[model samples]
Structures are given as structure tokens and as C-alpha cells.
Target chain A: MDERVLLTGAEGRVGRAVLGGIGDAYEWRLFDRDPPAEEHDHEFVVADVTDDEAVRDAMADVDVVVHLAGDPRPEAPWNSVLTNNIDGTQTVYEAAVETGVETVVFASSNHAVGHYETERKPDLYRTDDDYRLDGTELPRPSNLYGVSKAAGETLGRYYHDEHDLSVACVRIGNLTKGHPPIDYERGQAMWLSYRDCAHLFERCIEADYGYEIVYGISDNDRKYYSLERAKDVLGYDPQDNSAEYTMAGEPKSDV
Target chain B: MDERVLLTGAEGRVGRAVLGGIGDAYEWRLFDRDPPAEEHDHEFVVADVTDDEAVRDAMADVDVVVHLAGDPRPEAPWNSVLTNNIDGTQTVYEAAVETGVETVVFASSNHAVGHYETERKPDLYRTDDDYRLDGTELPRPSNLYGVSKAAGETLGRYYHDEHDLSVACVRIGNLTKGHPPIDYERGQAMWLSYRDCAHLFERCIEADYGYEIVYGISDNDRKYYSLERAKDVLGYDPQDNSAEYTMAGEPKSDV
Candidate 1:
């Protein structure tokens, strides 16, 4: 597999996590709607995912794509979500196919299956509720943004099935640095440490699949989401856990 | 509950089956993208599913919506499927949510779960595979059009869970009038009799559920999909069977 990758939305929080670790490992070509403050190791193209021409230009000679460019707000409105997420994702997928890119690691969110939370929340974080969220479960997105994310995952599937391209959808959880927020049980259960985030995405680039949906978070003891698929498919082995930061009943640190 | 319903795509082949018998009972506000040649008892709106304002206007005071709009061709291109199936569906669902409609009997197709056929296809049609396609199984759509339909189902789920809007997705089988098509064993086993189509939709109007996914075909002796859920949930008691038209081992009719 070629190490030459074009990472869109490379200036965002998840983007930084990826670049901070894998900067020297691969031949990087980053694209962002906004240019980052600090310079990168390789070429950085400032462009919008909605702009097809710009995406096409940035996509030239790229072996793989990590497409994360779009609106990420949970409560994003219809019009904004339409252009930023749905239309923009279509543009990217089309561009990837047009450019003959091998693989795409799409950043799908937990909200793609968020409605499960209404019934499986607090207990999923506690020592009870043996119930777990598997990748096989049908998506029940919570908001328009979640709908848009789900749309992205479906786009990946279409491209893969129709065009023979490989794709992986990472249903990412709450990402935090050093420690998870205090009293936020849900976030703690789903926390993806910065180190683990980078490694999980690295697996996205390395692994092989026709089309897959895997959870991207540290292997927390409180999690209801099964990491078996990720481990078996992507060779993922998460390191960090939210249990280290919390005391007996609550969090010890106040961030 | 009111026996009256507003059904879109009421002139198509599948629509004809659902409309032929139910026409005698419900006070329907029938609609079709294409204007039908014959006169009807209920109001018909000859407009596109993308037309949000027109749909919402028609949805006023209606208790249920049996939406079957959009291009149903399984091999449609990306743009065609994206706009007609995905975008049109989003518009309709948005309108349904806006109008405070109680239930939506969405015409989801068997192709939405067609990927499972890879392991058990022509053989499964001849003899039961001990495996049956259920509503709860993960969506493994075989084509882009199927992917679009799955997306529509997910959208229904979101609306139902988030806004208390009830939705029922019917993964319809090979719908034919008199008998199954020639050289099409898959169609024969999965044939949905015309009378049963009307019967199933009528059940949709009567059944009570927050969210459901049920097969929309007759109870055939030569079948793969289990009808337990449809029977239990929608009270779907199909009157016609494919075996009645065709004799054992000897060929008869291809409707």
C-alpha cells in the first residue's frame, strides 16, 4: 500500500491528533477549509469540500484519502447540513473515484446511532447493563447532523460496492486530552484519547475491507460498544481507558 | 383511527396493487408523480417528491402517509439515485415531521437487504436456507438505489425516535398481479399478490407501532423471508398465494 495520503479537514481537533503522530510515517498532503496556524511536514492545500474543482486539484496523485471535511455540529440546520455534509460528501466521494484513490477513512460519528442512548445510557457507563452496541445494529441517528454523517457512511458503501473502492467508517466517540470531563458519564465511556485516536486512524489507512463501520475510542471498561470488529478487522488495539482518571464514584481532576 | 390515507406514487405497479382493493374502503388523497389516465374518487397531486411545500400542503389533517415516491430503478446512477431517492425522501420526511403526521407507511424494498443473497440466492428460492431475512437484520443493500432506500428507512427511524413520529418500513418483495415472472424463481418465491398488497397497506393503517420494519408480500409456500413480524405487528393476513396459480413441478402462468 502507498503511504501517500491526502487528509482533508486536517486542521481540526481529530486532524491534529492524526498529524501529531503520523507526520513522519507517511507522505502527507493535507487539505482544510481553513489553513492551520502552524506549518505541516508536506503539502497543505486550503480548500472547501463543497468546491469540486479544488478537491479535484488536491486529489491528484493521492493514493488514499482521509475525508473529514464538512460541518460537524450535532444540531446543524438543514440547509447548512445539506451543503456541508451531504453535498460535500458526494463531491468528495465522486472526486475520490474520479482520481482512482484506493481507500477512504470516513469520520462517521456515534450520533449515527445516537437514539440508542435514550434507552442505553447511564447503565452503559456503570458496572451494569451487559447490553452492547455492535456495528451490526441499524443506525438510528439523533439529529440532522447525524443524518448527514449517516449519509456519508452510505456514500462510502455506494462507492465501494459500485466502484470497487475500499472504505472504512469510524463511528468516533467523545475525544479528549489527558482526561475525560468530570461527571460526564457518557463521554467518559466513549472517550478516545489523543494517542489512541491517531493510532486508530493509522489502522484505517493500513487495514483492508470492502466496506466497514468500526468504533474509534480507547478500550474503556465502561463501554457498551463492542470493539471486537475493529480488533478483528482493522487490527486495532486501543491503549488508554477513562477509568484511570476517575476516583471511586467521580472524577478526581477538574479540567 | 381514520380509515382515510394520503398515498403518493399511487399509479405505479406496486401502488396499483395497494390501491386496487383498498380503494373501496379508505378515503384516500391519492398522488402520483405522473398524472394517471383514469379518474379517481380521492384528490391526486401530480407533483414531485422534491416539492416540499406542495407535499406539506397536501399532508394537512391527514392521519398517515404511504410514501413510495422517487425513482425505483435498482441500477440508477449516483446523481439520479441521490436526488430522486435520497433528496426527495429527506424533503418528504421533513414535511411529514413539520405537518405532525401520525404514521408513515414507507415503501422500503427487499433490495435494501439484498446483499445477504450472495450466500443464499437461487438455492434459497428452491429450498428454505434455514435462514430468513428479518426486519431487525443489519441493512446490507446490494446497489446504490438500495443504499438510498436504506437511508430513507434510517431517516424514518430518526424522525420516530426524536419527534415521536411513527414509521413502518415495508421491505416489499417481487410484486406481480396474477403469477410470478418467467425464469424468475426469485420473483416466484417472493411474489406479493395484488390483493395482498392492498391487504398489507390496510394493515399498516390499522397496526400500532412506534417504529417497525416488515416484509410486504403474501404468505407464500416457496419463500425465504419470515412473515412472523408482519403478522404479529401489522396483523397482515394475506389472502392470496403463488402456489394457487402454479401447480407442483409443472409450470403454469407467469403474470
Candidate 2:
């Protein structure tokens, strides 16, 4: 509610989703490398996450940090991921610890464990497949970008254990704006609705977990990521399901 | 056994262990930041692992790369780990892929999953306790150094999946020269004898695996890390056990 939260990568898609749904929930400090397109009620700080002094300054009075800043491309080069994702994440964690920030809700991606889908593909995406990755599994990254995300998760674990920071890594899925991707079974299976994303992050800010990894997908019938940890730990009750929509990305009721 | 092996960090402890025992087994190309104090048969190249061109050059005509180069300190700073460990590992993986290297035996650390011992401490170190970390579990790093190792493991996973380079991460325990650690239950529990260390790495080079995380410890009776994966996959048969040593670290037979 009244806790001052720092949202890095505030110009990204996930940032927008979080803000659009829960814009007025918390007193927010929006941090991004790019300047805001339009003005807002929240204090927008234009600075890169890699800037240690800037990040520490921004976290002066913040209670929580929703760290979403990084190179989001799955095919990003090693240097880009190392600098933006891995180094930037370490900077955030260090800053949080120094400034006595209570919690950090890291925006890890499905790509962190993307290689798990290599052997089990179309079948795993279907509703009939009961196999699930519930965040307890080791990261089997498929790319350099995924490696960086997994690195961020490991950094979170370190900060939590050493510094007593309450850290939660949300392995976010495909987050489209209005609905899930059309005819993409994998996307549909791991779809995270805008509202659900916001609510899950809200729970992250509000919850009291020491260190946790939870999938950030909605309650979908055709899902490979189990949401039990998220539900139990963060009290996240997602409203949308990808199965409720038609194969063409339209709501079944609308069709 | 005559594979042209590139042993990174050839001047380090693990390198010494490998070279001491199995030095005659392979045609070796030793790569290290520090020049060797004494050298004879092997072609020694003194270069930092972070140096991309040097690493790539070192990989030329190399069949197997035992990549042990990095910041070896468990309490190393973030920058040190980032540059020497994480970035250096990426460089090795990239070079291996480019040079058509067959396998990379990564030197991961027990520190990568050190936090697992937080709840179950002294008890977990005992022979009576059946608790174990089997390498399939997610990394729960306790320090920046450990985080870097975990990051390296993720990088290996990525290289194996995307580039089809065989990778085996050896989560090495506390490797001592001749005997188990003295008066330290935790260290003794996961002690890795020098000969066993060399033999285990030899197995890593010989055996084939797509992507694996195996504990690199001797056959200790009071072990927390399970050696089943190593035994099954890499045919690692360690002969040393800490239980054979006295509490003061002397050999029971000699005493």
C-alpha cells in the first residue's frame, strides 16, 4: 500500500503491465534507461540499472524493488546479457542491500529454464501433459540471455541468504497485452495476463518470503509450469486462463 | 586417452591435482593467467581466461577443455567473479563452440548450492543423515562467488543446448592435497582427495554427456552431496573416504 517501491525497467512491457493494472496501489519510483514517453504521478528516474551510484540514490528510501531491467532478447549476445542482465542485476542486489531494502521481486524469464521444453515440446504445451517445472529444478538455459536470467536468480539467492533480503524470482511467461498469442500453444500454456502479472508482483511486494522461485503464469489448463509455489507463497490467485480463450486468441464467450 | 586437452587455470590447485596424477595420460595444452613456475612436456600458454582471442587461440586443435580458470576465492567480490568467472566462462564456451571442441569439463563449486546447508547444518554432515544434494536441484548460492559459479553452470547448459557442445559441470567440494580437513566436519564431509580429483576429471574427459551437473567429491562416508550421478554418468569411482582418517586428520591405519 504505502511502501515506496522502485520499479526498474519501468518502460518495458512487463513494467507497463504492472503499472497499467496496479498503477495507484503503491507509492512508486519508476526507473528506466529511457525517459518516460508521457508524464505520470509517480517519480520517474531516467538511469541505467548498471549505474551503481544512480541505483543506490534511487533506492534511498525504497522499501521494495521490482527489478525488471535487462536485455529482454532471448537471442542477445553474450556481452549484452553479461552487462545489462547479469552485472545490472548484481548492481541492483548490492544497492538493495546497502540501502536496507526489505524485498526484491526479480523478473526472471521462462528462458531461464527454456531447455526443459527441448525434448518435450508440443505435447508438453497441451492440456493432456501433466508434466510441470515448479521452480525447484536446475536452470537448463537454452541461450545466453537465459543464462543471464538464471544468473540473476542465483544472485537473488545470494543476496537473500547473506544479507537477509526477502527475494522472490518470478519466472515470467509470455505476457501479451489483451490476450494470449494466437494459435501458439506454448505461448497459450505459459500466458501471464496483465492483471495476473500485476497481482502476482503485488503479492511479491506484500509477502514475507525469505527466498523463493515461483512461476508467473496464470491458471491455464495447458501449462507446463506449475503455479503452486506462487499461489501458496505469494497468495497469488490468477483470474485468467489461456484455455478460456479460443485457439484464435479471442475469448470463448466473445466467440 | 591421447586427446589434445586444453586445461585452463593450469597453475591452480585442481590443475596441479589433474596434472600430477593424469599428466602422462593426455597431450596437454596448459592455459593460465600466471606462467608456470616449472614446465616440461606440455605447451603452456599464459593468458587470462577473460581474454577472448587468447581463449579462442588456446582452443585451436583442442579436443577436450577442462575449464578450471576463474576467481577461486569463495568470498571473492562481485566484480572479480563477474569478470574472471562468469565472463571468462562465456568466453571458454564460445571458443569451444568455434573451435569444434568435443567436451568441456567445467569446475563448478559446492558453494553454488551452499545455502542448502543453512537449515540442516551439522546433522547433514553426518553419515547417519540421509540428506543429500543430487545436483538436479536449483542453485541456492550463499555468496557472489557462488553466484558466479552457478552462472557458469547455466552458461554451460546454454552452450550444450544451442551449440551441441558436450558440457559436464563438476560441483567440486573442498579439495585437499593428501588427507581430509582437520577438525572441520563440514570440510571433511565433502573432502576431495587430490588423486580422486584427478581421476574424476579424467572420467569427465573420457565419458560422454550432453549437459550434466555432478558432485566432485571422494567416496566419503559422511557426505552431503550424492555421488550417484557422477558414478552412473561419468563412471567416477573415487577411492578415498574421510572416515578412514582420524579427527585430527591423520590416517587411521598409520595411527
C-alpha lDDT score of every prediction, in listed order: 0.83, 0.93
Query: Which stretches in model 1 have alpha-carbon errors above 4 Å?
Result: A51-57, A247-255, B247-255
Candidate 2 DockQ, CA atoms: 0.85
Give candidate 1's TM-score: 0.92
All models, RMSD in angstroms: 3.2, 1.4
Per-residue CA lDDT of model 2 for B1-255, tens digit only, reads: 779999999999999999999999999999999989886589999999999999999989999999999999998988999999999998999999999998999999999999999889989999999998999888888788899999988899889988899999999999999899898989988999999999999999999789899999999999999999999999999999999998877789864
State which candidate has the highest TM-score.
2
lDDT of 1 by residue, B2-53 (tens): 4558888888887788778778777788878889878877788898888888
Q: Judge candidate 1 at residue B79 and give its lDDT.
A: 72
Question: In model 2, where do residues sit more than 4 Å from their true spots?
Answer: none
For candidate 1, lDDT tens digit of each residue in A124-168?
787466778878888889898898888788778767766778999
Give the alpha carbon lDDT tens digit for every residue of A115-168 in model 2.
999899989998999999999888888788889999999899888988899999
What's the lDDT of the predicted structure labeled candidate 2?
0.93
